[model samples]
Target: MNLLHAYVSGRVQGVYFRGWTRGHAQRLGLHGWVRNLRDGRVEVLASGPDNALRELQELLYEGPALSRVDGVEIVAMADEEQPTHGFSIAPTV
Candidate 1:
């Protein structure tokens, strides 16, 4: 198992990015959260198989149709990030 932490920027906010992310993550059998950042970015944290994590990163780059993803900055998370059971939309931070 692995975790994926990504900060997606550029036209990411105000779109259905979080919803889309949650849907995809669930379909990929990942457990995670997606939220909007105050700085016009979307933050996603997912835990699943390594391949699923990588796939989520790619999907982050190609967000919802209304989104124009300019960049996705990936970060490594500590094992303690804590994996929950299901994907959901986290409150914006």
Candidate 2:
């Protein structure tokens, strides 16, 4: 299993990025959450098979066609400890 945390920048807010991310993550059978950061970025944490996680990250770049994703910063999350079950959209932070 693999877990990843991704922060998507550039016009990510107010564009359904979080919702879209949740759908994609769910489709990929990933667990974790997505939320809007105060700094106007979409923050997502996804855990699943390595291949699925990679596919989900790639999908984030397009982002429901309404988003203008300029950059994506990803890092491995090793402290989660426990596995996630399903994807969700979290309240803005």
Sum up the clashes in candidate 2: 0
Please provide, for model 2 over 2-72, each residue's C-alpha lDDT reduced to its tens digit, 9 standing for 90 to 100.
78888999998888888888888888888889999999988888888889988998988888777899999
Top-scoring candidate (lDDT): 1
Write one digit per residue (lDDT tens) for candidate 1, span 1-93.
888988999998888999999999999999989999999899999999989888888889899999999999988779888577999999998
Which TM-score value belongs to model 2? 0.91
lDDT of each: 0.91, 0.85
Cα misplacement distance, residue 53 of candidate 2 (Å): 0.4
lDDT of model 2, residue 32: 89
Candidate with maximal TM-score: 1
Clashing residue pairs for model 2: none
lDDT of 1 at 20: 96
List all candidate RMSDs to the true structure.
0.8, 1.3
